[model samples]
Target: MEESAILNNSECTRKCSENLSAVEDAIYVIGGKWKLKIIIVLQESGNIRFNELQRNIQGISARVLSNELKDLELNGFVKRVVHAEQTPVIVEYISTDYSRTLKPVIMALSEWGKTHKRNIREDAF
Candidate 1:
């Protein structure tokens, strides 16, 4: 039997291919070095100024953070609010309710990461 035929006949079926599509779509939206970190910070802090968010993340440049915020806002994951009432005025980025939907995903990733780190340490010894 050929390799392609074996794969087609085995576990890699149409359903699995469809699942790959969903994973790809997810990666397209949220796959990056800074996005999930930014979301996590906003999720924890509620609303934050640009400087605060930058300080929280650490090592991320202002230009990159600004670009990421624009992308997050465009995707409906966060909101940018300008408060004109205060003397100095305030600009804040807030996590949207839509962003809250990622809570389960974040929790799962955290759990898996912790477990993986433990496993790696165990193997090293």
Candidate 2:
């Protein structure tokens, strides 16, 4: 069952509404697994090339990463810059002001995960 369906009462319903709105906002920019990972990679380095992003994010296909970058650019979460002066033009991805705001949110989640995550056997992977 979804988390939204579990809040049954009126009071809980209001809280659930608020939670759902916040989740919507959060997911608007950070919806997919690779998108969040891409943002985190961009945060660590101010800008990166397509191949770099592909290498950093494990198991993501080139086509999927390309789609994710396009979606992020469309949403204003990431900026794509093409160098016109280069002999062969190159493209770089940079985080936008809107995406920069998510840094604190990512950091907070990282801290929380570190503190509360359960131990699992390496063999389970």
Candidate 3:
């Protein structure tokens, strides 16, 4: 192999490694069974109460939902609002503008998921 070829390969490997690191960081923040689902619901529903959000995400326990909400809030993906003055103290979760940055990622995943489902069904025949 030429020296230039070796150098090019090293650079390509470094770039690939860096890209994997970026993916890992994103997963750390938003990659879970419940986090993305919660984000999707909040983005679609505007400000939603805790119980309502829990119901929207069928099968998630309240404890798990609360923990996911805290993680999302900590990562700047969701915000918790409290209407303390109201008689019952309404609390709501809202998606942050920052979370909208995931729109393209979510769309890509949706497309890929559809494609994967189609391929699986075809193979099952």
Candidate 4:
């Protein structure tokens, strides 16, 4: 609620409460690296299983992926489908409509990062 804690010194305060609330909401949704990556992967792939996701993420540990999936589900960004049949159950993770809303924001950020990297590299060289 305080502008001092929300932003650093020397920064012009304009609608500090609104800006801080937006930042807080963004953090609440995409707080971790894994959550962002998971959302991207699910957005691109549509639907995937635990093992498939883990493989695609490269270095993400099993425990971390599991925890992230649970957190995503809890936050309503992802939907878990459990197929009951034989001994082992098949659980699939799919991006929910709420997560689809973030596609444009994520894609814009991705493009911005690419352009920023290109600019920096050209400046360096």
Which candidate comes out best when scored by lDDT? 3
lDDT score for residue 109 of model 2: 85
Give the clashing residue pairs of candidate 4, or none. Answer: none
- lDDT (C-alpha) at residue 50 in model 1: 94
Which pairs clash in model 3?
A: none
Which of 1 and 2 is the better model by TM-score?
1
Residue range 85-117, candidate 2, lDDT tens digits: 996899999998899898898999898776565
Assess the local accuracy of residue 68 in candidate 3 as a C-alpha lDDT between 0 and 100.
Answer: 96
Candidate 1 similarity to native, TM-score: 0.87
Question: Which regions of candidate 1 are displaced past 4 Å?
Answer: 1-12
Best by TM-score: 3
Q: Mind giving the per-residue lDDT tens digits that candidate 3 earns over 42-101?
A: 999999999999999999999999999999999999999999999988998999999999
How far residue 32's Cα lies from its native spot in candidate 2, in Å, is 2.1
Candidate 4 ranges beyond 4 A from true positions: 1-14
In order of lDDT, best first, we have: 3, 1, 4, 2
List model 1 lDDT by residue over 1-125, tens digit each.
59879887776677788899999988888889999999999999998999999999989999999999999999999999999999799999999999999999999999999999999989955
TM-score of 2: 0.78
Q: Score residue 107 of candidate 3 by CA lDDT.
A: 93
